[model samples]
Each structure stands twice: as structure tokens, then as C-alpha cells.
Target chain A: MREAKKQPGIAEVAAAAGVSVTTVSHVLSGRRPVSAATRALVETVIKELGYRPNPSARGLRTQRSESIALIVPDLTNPFYTLVAAGLQDVLMESGYLLSITDAAQPGRALPEVVRHVLARRVDGIVLASYGATDDDIASIAETGTKLVRLGSRFRADFGDVVRADDVGGMHDVVDHLLARGYRRIGLVNGEYDAQPSQMRLEGYTRALREAGRTADPDLIHFGTFSRAGGAAGARRLFDSAHPPDAIVGGNDLIAVGVMDAARERGLAIPRDVAITGYDDIEAASLVTPALTTVHNPAREIGRTCARMLLDRLAGKYDDVAREVVLAHRLVIRESS
Target chain B: MREAKKQPGIAEVAAAAGVSVTTVSHVLSGRRPVSAATRALVETVIKELGYRPNPSARGLRTQRSESIALIVPDLTNPFYTLVAAGLQDVLMESGYLLSITDAAQPGRALPEVVRHVLARRVDGIVLASYGATDDDIASIAETGTKLVRLGSRFRADFGDVVRADDVGGMHDVVDHLLARGYRRIGLVNGEYDAQPSQMRLEGYTRALREAGRTADPDLIHFGTFSRAGGAAGARRLFDSAHPPDAIVGGNDLIAVGVMDAARERGLAIPRDVAITGYDDIEAASLVTPALTTVHNPAREIGRTCARMLLDRLAGKYDDVAREVVLAHRLVIRESS
Candidate 1:
């Protein structure tokens, strides 16, 4: 193997071609569509820079296991499983097998899981981490292992990020509820420290302000992402001297719990307390007075992560971290 | 490495020790509890029979990538995910990372998925196969890889079987519904070829016979396991000349769809019509009038599969295939 420091890299080739590194990558990998003229220029630059695309690296790639590992916080959560489904569908088509492991299991934290996956020498890794530190990610990259971060737990600069627009999704949710003439709306969010929860809170506040209603801190309650958490938040709001006319769950599971709490108190859904949730999980529609919620594109996000990781493995680009934000939609059902 | 043809294996040692192969295995692995006296006798017999456990085999075991792969029909289903969760919890405690793959994805048939998993040389495989054939089982076994068959898709003689009691569970559901004085019960099952569907249908028939009522052919409907299938089946039963007084779903998803069908017809649950379902998944309780369903121990079944597979990998037993059937119970909620 030639010394990497002396060998010209893809960056040099891109610079000589006067095109983005990504364009140069696309020209090499042929993974994405590129203009014919741009492709020709990039091919010429590659030969001029003596950027021999690492013959030894190509040899190693041939011996590659052609398997990808996905580490998720909760395997039982439908959102994560749906993501796994999408990821598997795409990877399977390209002759790559996807191995999904869980991070929430005892003694199998994110760092520990990463070590085991790295030890297996998978071609790449997709991590849906909530508390992964910089060191955790750096360790994987340092090994020349392609990596893609799922969700908004880390900044875009950290690595390739594939996630839904949490802020915009939540903003749409609140605006929809307010438009229905529901005053004193309460938000029951997941743990406050989690980036998704924080972003959702920001969306709720912005929507409230845009509607000429001052955001009430008293109406905000944060808890775990389970039904128990949502129920606890709903109870707190219900017990307050001034309960909100509507309650919004951070996710479907929490929203289901809020409904449970309301029912326990003999409160009829929609008639007594309008309810809404995020992540239009099957349970949302299964519940009576089916929940009005945001349809977070979890499956699409998973597919995007697989594509991004595949691109990296194909030697597409080694530039700064890239990000892909999927779209979200409001699914209005009977609850509102 | 010594030639295996000239060496005494675990079976020979067990025969000379006058003990069961499993007992000798237990003494060797120390994974399960065994008496000290039995352990001493087994060790002594090993020395007398010149039965040297292959050192090369031991070295290979040491070099094994401590990871297991799980292949399920559908990754998006909560039942499989819950099982994966249970499997992960037990495997993690033993320092084993589990990689889950889906067989239902396009271009990723069961055999193809198995080939990829085998190519990666996983320590063991846990397959929740629906249509796997004898060739599939023989191929995995021929590789000298540890295997555990999840679900009732295959017979116990084929390999290690870990599954819930589908027949007994469905029987209990029927008995409960009968006790509630609901006559003219119709069953909507999954595909006719599936072992679970067959077993469940048998249970439903046996219950009807014991109650001195014959199962009407028109009352039996077969469809896919999704919500649309359930709803379609329910609609058929509803439009029949003699609509069933109650409907039973093969699984919870189908039951939710049955609920949808009833709602579309403006029928009040348990009043104008009664409903029941199998697999008391999260959606069972989340749905209105909660679901009267069988509580399938999917997670426990998953845990059992992991333990069984680990025992095999530990060289505990290589005799005839083993089987473990977990228990199931009927959960009578309001929907009944």
C-alpha cells in the first residue's frame, strides 16, 4: 500500500476539476446522477492528479463482509423497527445484509455495542444514538469505518445525519390544534435533555407566539418517552388549577398514555379533552377517536441512512458531514 | 489438528460414562446446574476413554466472533421486535451482540438471507421462518453452525424449536368467548398454509365441537396478517346472510382491522357485535373497548430461543433436536 500522505486524495482531484468533492465522488462511484460534461472533467482531473484510487483499498473492499450494522436505542419501539425495515429493504437490494442491534439492553450501551460491531469488521455502521458522545463516533471513523448517524442526537458536522424535520413537524402539530379553536393547549414532551424533545418544544413555542398567544411555561411537562410518562404529564396538567383544553403528546406512545389517564378520570376523548400525538404509529389510529398526529417519516429516514452509508462505502465523498432532512405531514383524525 | 475420525467425541464419552449426552455436556460447559458427583464421574470417564476434546476446536471457539444473527419474516411487526428485544437482553448479558435481518424484504428471500448470514460466519442463527424448507435447515446445520428455529414453522425433529402454544391459546380464547354466551363466532385467520394458522383453526374447531356446535365453513375466512386482511374478512362475515354475532382475528393487527370494519357498519362493540384477537400486542389494549385476546409470550419465546442457541454453541448438546414451548394465557378485556 502506498503512503496515504504522499498519494493525492479525492479532494485534490475535485479541486483540479473545479467541481465539488461530491460531484467528483459521484463521477467515481456513479451512484447519483451527474451532468455528462462534469463527469468528463472529473475523470480527466483524476488521471492528472495521479489519484490512483487506492488499489490496495480496492483489494480490501473485495474481501469486505458486505454487511452493515444498525444500533438503535429501543428495538421494540415501532419507529425504530420501521426504520430497520426501510434500511433492510434498500441494503438487501444492493446485496448488503443489515444487522440491527439494540443499545437499550442492559450491559449493551451505545459505546459497548459500537465496540462489538467494530470488532466484527462490518463495512459500515448506522447508529440511532440518543446519548452518543464525540469519542464514540470518532472511534468508529478512526478505524476507516463508514458511519451515518440517525436522528438529531448529534450535529450535522459530526457525520452523515438522516432524520425528519422534528421542529417543523411539531410546529405544524401545534398550529393545527390552535386552528381548531383549542385554547390553553398543553404539551407533554419526552425527556427535556434529548435533542428531539428540545426541538419539539421550540416548535411549540414558536407556533404559540405566531398565533399571538404567549407560551405558558406552566403547561409544559417533560417525562420519559413511555405511556407512564405521558400519563404522568397529563395528570399534572389535569390537576392544575387551570387545565388546558387540549393536550399534545411528544410521541404516539406518550399520547396513548395521555388517553389512558384521561379515561381513568372519566374524561371523554375530544368531547372533554382534545388529544394529539406525534409519530402516527399504528396505535394512534387504533385508539378510539383516533389521534390527530404528525406522520414522522421514520421508514424513509432509515432508507436515507442506508443510502448515505452506501455512498460513503463506494468512496463517493470524504468531505464534511452531510445531512438529509425528510419531510413530515400532519394526519388529522377524529381526536381534534 | 488431530483427525476427528480417530478421536472420541462427546457422545462416546457420555456412553462410556453411562450418563446422558446432555449431562456430560452440562459438566463440560457448566452453563446449567449439575451435581458434583455426576460431574466427577463424567470427568473421570473422559480421561479413561482417551476422549480428548479437540484443542483446535477449542481454539476456533475462542476465535469466534461472539455475535448471533436473527432472521424474521417481518421486521416492522411489533411481535417480532418484542421477541428481538427479549433475545437481545439475554444475549447482551452474555456479551453477545445480536444482528437482526428481515426475510420479507424484496430480493431478500429466506434462503438468500440465510446465505448472507452464513457467509458472515455468525456463531449461531435464530430463524423465525414462515416458509423455510428442509433444504434451508440442512444447509445451516451442514455448516456446523448452531441453529434454533423460532415459531412453529418447522417441526421439533428438524432442530431446536422455540414457540408459544398457538393451539392452546386459541382454544382458550374460544372457550372464553363461549362462556360469555356468544354464539355464531367467526374466525379470520392468516394464510391457510401457515402452521400457526392451522393450529389456531384446529383449536377453534375443537372448542366448537366440545360445545356441541359445528364450525360453519362460511364462518372461516383466511387472509394475510395485516389490518386490511382482517377488515376484508370481517366485511365478508358481516355481509353474509347470517352475520356472525362475534368475530375473532388471527392476530391483534387483524383484530384492529375487524374493529374498523364494525365501525364502518355503525355497529357498537359488544352490543351489536363482539370481537376477539390473538397476540395481545400493544395495539390490542390501545384500541377502543380494549381487545379480548391471547397474551402470546413473544419476548419470552425470544429469550428461550437465545438460551437454546447458546447452549448449542457452548457444546452442551448435539444429540436430537430440542424443543421449548412457552406458555400463553387469555387476556379478557372489554372488547369480548
Candidate 2:
């Protein structure tokens, strides 16, 4: 390791500027009145020295944490984490730092989690998790901070929302499968009550109905939104007397799981059990037979959420909650 | 969506608690002295109403952002994003919000970024980007903020560093390939100047020498740490007059690219050409032949970085810098 040079201290910055330390502190923090010439001098010295105004001392003057909290289910998924990256891209530039937390685990109610972050007096909270309860929504409403929701499909809605048109995306997936001459198509979906789950299920049934085929409730299996969930759903379909020739996973992770199960059965993908999925994650293309799936702009959703929160922070929209539904498309690959 | 109720205002809390609004604000921000009884009363009402004191108003009293910035190249890669998530996990519980910034794009100097974020008055910065320049190191040294460098491998390092054992891990990969009867093994490495690339190259050549095989300089390909670089390297290898039967990618994305290139050439993985990768990301298992690679604990690295920064913030060790080297394991899978 290279030896680190000692950085200039606040006292050195004050001394270089030919001002009292208090004057320099006040000039940096904007807590007290100071002459414009003196302020400029202090700032120039700070710049030359690369001095960082003591954050704690400045916080007393600003009365703001200048931080935002992003609550997601987890970061294990590339999709969720990428969204976070996107949000950071926007917020970091705006001088507002974003902190992320996982609320997907079974314990720790959403309200409690939000309360814990709010206790820090963060400037904003972006609720990007799934199935936020009514109480959770109410708790978030208690704070005046800007709030933006990702996948806001719950019946009791609050906050600016960035949602995906998964319904249309799923319809396209089913249509593509139908066009490929695959009959007995099955669906691997998330929880029944989740907003995305219901919308996707509706699209799946609607696609079958539009093709002059009756929807088969038996063909639809609900599980958690995870790889294990998809694997279990595929197993249920395969073990049944009437196994579907094609399966559409709610997300890429689930589709990967389904593919794993099929491989264990020595089944050739696309040749035997054609699989499709939503959320065209990076793995969707890397997998053996690249998964045929719907491409949801997850990062874009994150960016939109951050922008909406920033707009709220800026009062650009003035109490008018904006609902943004991002676009999606069907991505064809080797799997289908 | 259910209609949201009107949340109680600060004035309501003050009225209910029988305290003045200034007292309530002071109690929340800790800016001014408040009587113990009055502070407790104000707190109870604030809890009952679930009120979040306006961040800006509170900032005047506290004078701190209470946030940290994490500078990473990009989160599109699961490896980088997972590390950010790990840091968030540790920082959130300590009442500190973590902000993330991307330092990976070409042309934008790293020091400029560190300075820009420093101007935001963030409490600290956890820099997780690779290949920091001397200017970047010097710029970081100019700030009083606590800074932790992730993946820093330079012999002369400044600041706390968290690194993985990629060198030993690469040696194991070469040995594994040699044991499998692959004599002509090629290495698709990253930037020659970077620490991991140099270390991995050393391990690869050392393993061949120890196994009584002459190391071939012609078989080494240096490229960027990306999938495209790997694909290009693979093409060069195949087009060579003497092509190796096995290739070791510096990282997983590179290996994935190699697989892509091989497939385009009508080559069957493991049968025609075996490929290995480092950094056993989630994609490693999801790929066609499942990439055989080194398992670097990315999340653990993030956690350790965060812990080190927190310890510094708490002054636990009284100004001594700590260097943490994380362990890596060889994951044997179908690719080899």
C-alpha cells in the first residue's frame, strides 16, 4: 500500500483563508451571516485544500440529513439491485444519497422498517418492495418526506408510483408461445394477491381466451416470487397427468428454476418443454438456451422512481401524485 | 386504491404533548435544550402520531447529513451491486443511510467524483471501484472523511482495503484444468496493470511451471474485464494456428463470452473446448455448462468494508487502518 498523505485540516483551511475558524465554519455551513468576499475566500481555500466541511457541524445548519431510503425486497436479484443502481445514478447526482434496505424477509413489518429509517430524519423514502400493507402505507403517509413506490398494485395506494405493464408484457409472451404451435401452455406465477401476480395472471388468461382456447385454472400455479417458487411450480406441472408443453415463468429467476427441473428430467429445452419468462435479466441471455422472456425495464423503473421523488422534493408537481407505467416488450431467445 | 388519511402535523403533536412547537422541534433535532419531562411528553405524542420531523428543519439543529456514499463502477454487474447491498445491510441498522455513485464510466476522473460527492457533505465514502489512479488516491487523501477502498491491490495503498484471494484461486483453476488432461490451456486475462489480472497471470503460469509444463506467452491474452473482451480473446485463440483446448477467463462474464464465441463456431462446451471463470456469480450456475470458477464472497466483502468504516467512525481502534483480505474457494462444476 502507498503511504497516504495527510489531508488539510479545517483549521488549515481557515488559516489559509486568513479568517477565523468560526468564520470558515459559518461560510461553509451557511449558518451565520458572512461577508461575500470572505465567503468566497474561504471557499477557494477549501477547494484548493480539498477540504470537506465537517458534515456533522454543517448538518446543524442545514437541518436535513440529505439522505433517502430505498426499501426493496432484497438485492440478491440482479433486477432489484440494478434498479437500485439506477436510482443511485440519479440521486447521487442530485446531491441526495440513497440508502437501501430489504423488507422481503418474513419478519419486520413494513411500517416498523419505514419508522426505523424515518427516525433518522431522511429527506425521502422510496418504497420499492412488494405487497405493502395498508398500515405500512399509513405509516409512510405520516412523514412529509417524498415517497415513491415501485410496483404499486395494492388496493390501498399511496405515494408516487413507477409500475410496469406486465399485463401487456405477459400477453405478448403467451401470444409468442401460441404462435410457435405450443399447446397445453402453463403459467408459473407469483403470490395470488400481489399486484403484479394478478395482472400477469389476467394477461395469461386473456391471451388464451383471445386465441379461442378456454383458460385452464389447473394450469396456473402460484408460488413465492423466487427461483425455488418457480421450480416448485414446474414440478407440480410436470408431475401431473397432463403436463404442459410450455411454461411461462413470472420472472427470470423462476424460469431458471423451471429450466433446472427440466434439465434434471433430461428434457431438452425448446425441443421438449419450451420455457418463457418475464424480467429479461442478464442471466436470461447467459443461460444455456437463452430464455425467451419479456423485457421489463427495471433500471428505468428505478430511475423513474428517483426522478418522481426528486420532483416531489422540488415540489415540481405540487401535491399531484404522478403514476408512471414503464414499457415492456417480448424478447425472443433460444429457450422458446 | 384506499384513500389515505390526513397525517397529524407537528403543531398537533406540540398541542397534544403540551409543549411549544420549538420545544418539540428541539427534542426531535436535539438542537436545543429541552426539559426532560417535556422531551418525554413530546416524544410520546410524536410516536402516537407517527410524525417525522421535517428533515430540513431538523438539519438546522443536527448539522449533519448522516449519510455515506458508496462509489462503485456500476451495479449492472451482480458482483458490484451485491457488494453495495451488503454495505447497506450493515449501515442501515446503525442509523446511517448509504448513498451509491458510479465511478466506472470512461473519461470522468475518479477524483472529480470523490470531490463532487464530498461537496454533498456525506459523512463517509465507501469506494468499491477498481484501479484507482495516483491522482484519485491523492484526492481521497485530501478529504477528512472516512474512506474505505474495495479491491485495492496496489503495493503502496492508502486507506483500508478489502480484497479477495483471486491469485490462489486462479492457481487452483489451472491445476484443475491440468488434472482433467487439458495440456494446451489458454488464459484470457484483464488489464495487465490491474492487481487481479497480474496476480491471476502469475498463478496461471506458476501452476503450469510447477506441473512441469512450459508456460507459453503466446497463450496469454490481455483484455478488459468484460464479456466482449473475453469473446474477442476467445476468437483470437481459436483463429490462432495453435489453439488451446481449454481457456481460463479472468472473470465469469469473460467466460460467458468465451462460451458464446465457441458456440458460434459450432463447438460443444466441455466436449470441444472447456472454459473456466473466476468470481462464481449467480450466472456461473445458470449458464449452459455451469462455469467452473472461484467463489469470491462479494457480499461478505461489502459487509466487511462497511464494518471497517463503522469501526473507524466509532473510533474503536484509535486511528489504526485495517486491511481485510477475504477468502475465496474453488467451485468445481460442469464447465471443467
Candidate 3:
């Protein structure tokens, strides 16, 4: 390997800027405010010298990597990526590097993916799990890594939990469909075993019960949380003799698929069958006859997750795991 | 900061697995062949003990973080995310953590973002740059950091360059449109100064020249690579007294916007005006009248980039910078 030329250190930066090392430290950490002019001069000199505070060297002294790792089920999903975007916003502000790993991609088992990240020994972790077990959660905590779960399946005590109101959002959307005078509301949800799916199903049932009607088992179909999955479920519902007058998709991608299926079957939206979705992804608004869905604040949830993790790392919170639930609301659009 | 408990080490794994320390090391690194039965036993013990080869500890001894950083313009765009997905597939196989940062989001200036990541002292950097300068590229090399540029603006000697065949891809698409006998063609391209835009424009001109027709400056529009931007550009082209019979969107997102604009103006796709897009993003096929565009193979580009970086780090290749250009093809779909 070619030997790298000597890297400029804090002393070099201080010398170049004609300031004491303490002044340069203050400028870097922002723990103590320096004069604006001095700060600018120090920054300019640092840039001109191409000097960087080696994180590894700093980590050795502080016992902190100054980095956080996020493990998501899939990076391709818009919802997860939006959540990541939100997490990055806050973490970067605090000078923490965010490393994201997709658990589902490249066919790594959820447990193995978790273990792999744990080995990295990051300062903290924000796990947006899809199929992790209780054992997996316990293993992370055992390592004493600052743990925050996004849409967690375990109880609040397991870790700092940050999730949108999946159940309430689903309930409101179903209620809206009921108020629209659609009695037979067929629901196509995601994997039946997933936490979000179960929560959303509970909301669907609650809405039906409030209307003095029990949810028909035949009207609910569980599948993957994808457009193709939504289309497949829609097909099964439409092919039935007792097909409903309206359909509710578990998420925006599913709703888009339902729309596609409706078009394929020569069904005019809201004329032949009304549709509603959840998550309120970007495509939800862009699609024709804009989808009526629930506004799940994915980005806010991400920001909240990062803040919770940072609080623990900063010693602002105790060992007691906390739970935070962000509000979700109905987004009534043309589809319904 | 609460103190974390000491973690299980390789010795713990070795004791539990009934193997020597070297045997466990070989299993983790895969530097030598081990019997399948012993490998499985060692892995199970490692998982059971929750033993992780702490990267910080290993990094201290080996002077390697076993991590790579990817910097992109935006994470929300499907194209970049797909690239990240591809990069992750290879990096994970080599036991390297991938840290991705969006340079555009949260409104961080590009140079600042670059500087911020450089301080982390990662093993390598896969910079999918949008607006980085020659100085920015040079700074990375000066630090002895293994640098790979995805879609680099500079020549190959600056760093390893991995990109798709933007020029040839555009040329093929334009030629296809010409063969269909579309006399008047307008091009809605990305930012005027971007390398991709320049290369694509070159292809468009080359095709027009081959057809014995000089390109018209009035028919070209430059805007952001977004659906809204495409719509605005389309409006200008449509409002013209002599609007072109065909339009080429800079990317799939732009094409989708053009389609929306056409619908609002009561123009039928391919009937009233033919439309083509580049990139062939997921929405390209999902959109109504599926977009006829170029398949840029974003994931392949990402995989190739990771491979190139890894090869350099492994010392399999010399310090000389290399360039790899993957092929692009026209995906003829319903829109055209």
C-alpha cells in the first residue's frame, strides 16, 4: 500500500489560523461559542488545509464511534427511505454519521443482518424491523448498544419505540369509507403476521364494530406490501361473487395496484368501485383520481427515532425504555 | 453515559464451538477452507454467544474500518436508491458496512457534505457526485483514501470512474424515434451544466445529424430532473405556435410529468404526440401507456462501482485509475 502523506491535525489547523488549540476545539465542538470572525477564519483555514478530525482517532479516546447504524427491512420502499431521510437530518446536525443497512435485500436473514450490524459496535442503532424476533431485540440490548425501534413488535419496555398511529390511521380511513355509504368494504392488507398489518387489521375491525357491523372474513386478504401483491388480492376480491362495492388497500403502493386492477377490469374508480389506501406515499397524490389514504408521517417518525437514540447516547434519558406515538390522520382525496 | 458491559470475544466463541482461536478466525475471515460441519458449529456458537468481532478493535489493529461511504445527490430519487441497493449487495459480501449520505437533502452544500464524510476516515468512498469540483476529487486522493467516482465529471486519471453509456443510449433512442418518421422532435433535458445532460444532448445532436437534419435550438429546454420541471418545460414547448410532434424527457420522472401535461391538454400519447424517457425508473413501466425509454441499468452500475473500489482496496489492481462504462439499451414500450 502506498503510504499516505501526513494528515494535518488540530495543532496544524490552530497554527494556520493563528489561534490557540483550545479556540479551534471550541469551533469544532461548538461547546463554547467563539467570535463569528474567529470561527470563520478557523473554518476557512481548516478547509484550505483539507484537515479533518479523524473519527477513529477521536473514537479511541472518547470510546464513542460518533456514528449510528439504521437497519431497515427494505431500502427500495419509499416509506423506509423517507424515514432514513428524516433520521439523517437530525443525526447530521449533531455530528453523527448514519450508516444504513437493508435487512431484506441480498437475501440476508433478519437475525443475521442484525448480528452483522451489532458486530460493527456503532454508538447506537435505529432498527426499523419487519420480522425480527424477541431474541434479536434482547441480543442488541445485551450488547448495551443504545437501541431505538421503529414500528417495533415488542412491548415498549423492549426499547425506545417510535411509530406512527397505524391502527388509528386505518380506523379513520375505514370510517371515512363507511361514511361514504360503502357497506361492503373489502380490505387488502400486508403480511398477516407483521406488526403493522395486525395493527391495521385491528383498526379495520374497530371501524366496522363502531358502525354496528362485524368485519367479514371474506372481505379481508393479507399479502405482501407491494403493488403486485395488492393487485393479486384485488383480483381475488373482484373475482368473487360477493365482491364489495369498495376496496381498501393497506398502503399507497397497494392502492396504486388496486387502481391498476380496476382499470384492467374496465372498472371506473368511484363509479364502479371506490378505493382508499394508507401511508399516503408520494405516488398516492400523483396517481390519477388521487388516492384517499391515511397520512402516516414516516419522516417525522424517523426524526423522532434519531432524537430518542441521541437522547440516550447523550445521557438525557435513563435505562427505562420509552414509547412515542406520532399522530396520523385521514387524507381524503378523489378516490373515495 | 451509562457504561456498557464487556462484549463476548472470539475466544468465547472458540471455547463454545470447541475450536481453536485460529479456527474461529478462519471461519470469520474465510481466508482458508474449513470443514462444513466445523464452520456451521462455529457460526452457531458465535450467534449464541452474541460474539461480534468488534470493528473498532479490529480497526485499531489493522488500520481499516471495514466500511465504505456512498455520497449521492438525493436518496429519495429511485435511481440513486437502486444504485445504493446494488452497492450494498457487494459490500455486505465483503463484510464492509455501507454508510450513505444525501448531499442535497437538508440543504447542505455539496462541498461541505464531501468534507464532512471525509473526516470519518472510511476505508473507501463511492462518490456518486452531481456537482463536486476538481479540487474536491483531488482532496480525497491526497488523503490516501481509496476513491471511486460514480458518474464522475473528471477524466479517469482522477479516480476510478463507473457510469452507464449515457451518450450511446440517448443516440439509440433518438434514432428509434427518427425511424418512426417524427419530423419535429423536442428535447427536455436536465440541468444544462450536468455531465449526463451534456452527453445526452450530444447523442441527440448526433442522431439528428445522421438523419441529415440540424438540431434546432428553439426545440431544446433545460430544467431540473423532476416531474414538475418536465411539466413546465412541456408547457413552453406546447405553447409554441409550431410545437414538435414528439418530445424526449430527460428521465422517467420527467416523462411522467410530460404525460400528465399531455393529459391536461387533451393530447393522446403516441397518437397526438409520441413521448420517450431516459433512466427507465420503476414508474416508467407502471405509468399508463408504459414509457418507452432507455434502460440505464442503475443497479449494475452500482455493483460495478463497488467491485472497482474493492479491487483497488484489495491491491488486486495498481494505483492507476480505471474507467468502466456499462451498456444501455432502449426499452421499447407502449408510450412510443
Candidate 4:
């Protein structure tokens, strides 16, 4: 029994049950009809022998890879991972697997990624952070593959988009900073060409205009959406002849960099130069003085995106040109 | 022409070529032979239609699912995402799709997860940051699936294991802290049974003993491997009458919590209370008083695990069972 158990294969089960491999597969999957006597014998043999069909073999008939793709702008950032967790949760429940791709590499490889996902024939695709160009988005829309964009907004006439209210969220942060008596506010922005960066910069400028404060071009520094970029930006801000009293970074990593820059210059947070960040990642709460930042709903965005894609795949939504904007919150900690 | 280019279906390609769907499929996939003239005509029509095979349709083949599974403890941690990125880098090159699952939820649902992965028939499985019990591991091994463990060392009669030098790495951290003149050191550990936690604890004790210092039971606290747990453990350490002058956490998240605890108590790091952490995640560098921690080779570990699994699948190294232990480094920062 032990020897037989050690080498339990489909052939052993088929032979034991007096059936062929095809017959066994037909009985197991019920893709075709089989005699009750033969079915019962196969079932008994399968149960007794602990016979399991190779997954690779069974996958051939379903025409469903049962997998999806998750493309994020960066993996080093904790925010995307949290979003990934949420997406994985929902997709796993529906028996779909997720493949993750980083979009922040050189050239931002979205086109190649799209081709790979298509080649693998994934059930759907989730764009976690990359903003799709018109051409790419249009192609995806035409391909009839379900797509959900996370933390990004696009004009493409395809797929549902899940985004946080960056404008409103930034407004809250600016208002709170003002209420806290931070007058000379500086903005550490990301690349101006990116949609989120543009929206955030606009929000900053709009808030300053509303508050009767001139938006100083010198106060704004543009860099990559990263901690080093934030650090460098902070250095530039500090080097300026007229340093702002408070700095608002494009995202939390930049905020952390600004904090590092402040500490390097012997400046204290909130006491000497207040700082704030966006995307309220896990690091926001873990950083010293904790970080006063805008809470972008990363996980919620991911879950909503996955659910939206699943809905689209299941024909729950007929219109592909739908947008779902999620809400973001402003969390004030010691930095402000 | 533009409208025709917008929708490329197999039927359109077949109709354009005046061939049956089966003939077109056979011609395109090379499953069976067709006349040269018909094949050439079908190819031209396929190109004209811009027809791409639906991955869902191709997935129905039994021999190759072209999908893989990545199981991790949590994605909220940046380390796992980094590892995921490395795994994706390799798997993507081979045209395999990936699905990720978080096993941190209560009860972990390992059996269900196994069944799901089996049903999908992933070409292989990668286990990261999580470990399976003997029975569960044995069951998976019995199924003849190619399995690889990342950042974990477990020997089963079947499957491969990959791990980092946890004991040696912890010793490096402890020695560094000791060299920095930190005595009366405390240890903040994860759940007692976790593999890394147990190994780290052993190294901590061994280091203290080697330094001719008696181990203080009161200085050790076990908590969840999270920031909250670290915070709680730090509070316990400080609230005690004999608060240690230094603290070592099992991981970076716990160390971040300890840093918070020190700030709340007004203890100056590296002066009043030096702290060290393990797993040099991004936050370890970004946090205030940048964390001095052990740098586990996360990406290397992930890449090595993938290679090991691929080698097993390819029938390489059949005669010998082997283990690969990667090296780790201690990154010194402001915290200690």
C-alpha cells in the first residue's frame, strides 16, 4: 500500500478503475457524460488512491488561465504593496491569481507589459499606478480585456478607473496647515507632466490663491516621486534665500526625505520647519513625530479596481467608459 | 480600415481567409497541418485582422497553464514587494503569469489556498515570508508539485527550501550594537514560533553569552511582527523598573515602534536608548534617526528561490538535496 501510494498517478487510478485516462478526465470534470458504473468505480479508485489530476493538465480544457495582472509604478513604496494586498484578497476569493509588474523601470514599460499580459491571456489587468497614454488605453479598450486603473485618472474610453480625490484631499491638508498657523508654505512637487502631479500642484496653487497668498515659483521644487527626490528638493528649498516655514511634499516618500534634510540641517519638525506629505503610507505613521500627510485610499482603490474589473468581466457593467473616484482623508500628525 | 482594425476577432480572421475556425486555429497554433496555400492566406488575414489569441482560450490546454503562485505573509511590508518584483522580473522573462496570495489572514486558510492553486494548476509555487506545518507541507509535497520556500528553511522529503543566514545576521546586529557601547540591551521579538523569530532569539542569547553578559529574561518580549506589536513591546520594556539602555527588534517594523516609544518617553536615541532592527526595509532608512538594522538579501533570496524551483521543474540536481543560505549585512544608521 505504501509503495502504491508513493507512485499514485493518473494511469494507476485509470487501471485500478478499468477506465481510460480520457474517461477518467471526463468523469472528474463532467465535461462529457460517462456511465454511472464507470463513474462510481473511478470515484472510488480516486478517493482510495488519493489521486489528483495535475493542474497543468486540467487547465487545458477550461480556456481560463484564472490569472490577472497587477501593474504598479513602484514596488519599493509600501503604498503599492498595500494596494496589491487588497487586490489579491478580492481576486483570490474569486479563484483568480494575480501577476504583479513594476512600471517604474526605465522607459516605464507599459506597452511591453500590455503585450505580455495579452500573451499570457490573463482574465483582466489592474493598473495600480501608471497613467495610460491615449494610444495604449485605446488599444486596451479595443482588446475587450477588463482593466481597472488604481490611483490614476485617464481620459481613455476604456475600463473603469479607481482614484482618490487628490484635489479635495490636498485642500484639506492645506486648510489644516493654514489653521495650524503655517504661513510661509512650500510645495515639493513631482514631475509636472504626470496627471496626479499636475492635479496636486494645481491644488496647492489653488489653495494658496484662495488664502490670498501668492504662489511663489521658488517655493516649488520638482523631482521624482521618491524619497531621494524629496530629500534633494528639501535641500533646494533650504538653500533658497527665503525658506518657507512649512513644506508640503508630493507624496510620503518625499516628505520623509524633507524630514531627513531638515534633520541634517539641525532643523526640528513642526518647531523649526513644519512638513507634510501625501499618500499617508504605513511609513507616515511610523516616522518620528509621525508624518502629517494626506491619506490616499490605496487598499480601497485596489479593492475597488479589482471589483470593478471583475464586474466588467462578469458583464455587470455594459459601459466601459465609467469612472469610480474613491475618497481620501487628511491625517494630521506632529509634522504639521 | 480603422474600424476593422479596432475589433480583431478569430472569426473575423477566419472569415477574411475563407477558412473554418478549426483550420485557422490549427494553422495559427500549428496544432495540425494545413495546405500551404490555405496557411499563407490565413496568416495574411490574421495579420490584417491583427488577431491576438485570447489567453483565456489558450489556457484550456492541459499540459501547460503558464501560471505561477506567490504566497507571502503580508504585502503591507515593503520587503515582500521587493521580493515580488524580483520574482516577477524572472518569471516575466519566461512568459509565465503570477498570482500572489497573502497568508496573514486569521487561520491562514492554507488548505483552501493549496486547493485553489492546484485547481488553477500553477506551473510552480513560491512561498515567501510564510511557512507551512509539517503535515500541510507534506501534503503539498505528495502532490508532486514543484515548491520553493523563500526566506524560510524547511526540509521535506520533497520540495526545495531557501533561507537567509538569520542567526549570523542577528549576531552582526547584536555585535554592532554592543560595539556602540550599548549595554542592558532588550530584545523585541515576534511570535515565539515564527522561524526567523526563534533563530533571531537564539542569536541574541548567544551573542549576550559570548559577550560574557548574562541573559535577562525580563529584557525579552514577544509580540506580533508589526509596528503595533513593537510599540507594545517597547512600552513594556520602558515601563519596567529595570528598563534596558538598548533595544533590538526582530524586524524593522518592530524597531520603528520602539523608536516611537522612545520618542514618547523623551529618550534620545544612541544617547539614552540605542535601538536596532532587522530587515532593512525602505522605512528603516526613511524614519527619523534612520534605523540601524540587518539587511536581509531580499531580492537575491527571491531570485534564488525562483531559480531553484525552475531547476527542479527542469530535472536538474536530481541526485542530491541541497540548501542555499544567502548572506546578510548590518547597515548602520543614526538610530544606534
- Which predicted model would earn the best lDDT? 3
**lDDT-superior candidate, 1 or 4:** 1
Q: Give lDDT tens digits, candidate 1, residues A1-336.
A: 011134466778888888888898788789899999999888888877646443223324453557788988778778888888888778877867577788876677888888777655577888886777778877776656777887665465566888788889989988998888899999999987767788888889999999999878889999977888999999999998888889989989899989989999999878788899998887888888889999988888888998988898787876567888889999999988
Best by TM-score: 3
Clashing residue pairs found in predicted model 3: none
For residue A140, give model 3's deviation from the true position in Å.
0.9
Task: Please give the TM-score that candidate 3 achieves against the real structure.
Answer: 0.90
Model 3 Cα lDDT, one tens digit per residue, B234-328: 88889888898889998888888888888889999898888999998777877768899999899898899889889988987786778888899
Q: Give the range where candidate 3 chain A is weakest over 10 consecutive residues by summed lDDT.
A: A151-160
Candidate 2: tens digits of C-alpha lDDT, residues A1-336:
333445566899988988889998788668899999999888888888767655444444655556788887766777887787778767767767667777754444466578778777666788876767877776667556667888766332476778999889899999999999999999999877777888898899999999999777778999977888999999998888888999999889989989988987888999998999889998898887889999988888888888878777776876667788889988999998
TM-scores, one per candidate? 0.80, 0.86, 0.90, 0.85
The interface root-mean-square deviation of each model, in the order shown, is 17.7, 5.5, 3.2, 5.4
Task: Give the winner by DockQ.
Answer: 3
Model 2, global lDDT: 0.80
Candidate 3 regions exceeding 4 Å error are A1-4, A9-51, B1-4, B9-50
Candidate 4: which stretches are off by over 4 Å? Answer: A1-63, A106-108, A154-156, B1-62, B129-131, B156-158, B239-241
Q: What is the Cα-based lDDT of residue A27 in candidate 4?
A: 90
Best of the two (3, 4) by TM-score: 3
Which ten residues in a row are the worst by lDDT in model 2 chain B? B55-64
- Error of model 1, residue B202, in angstroms: 1.3
- The fnat score for candidate 2 comes to 0.45
The ten-residue window of minimal lDDT in model 4 chain A covers: A1-10
Q: What DockQ does each prediction reach against the true complex?
A: 0.16, 0.35, 0.46, 0.36
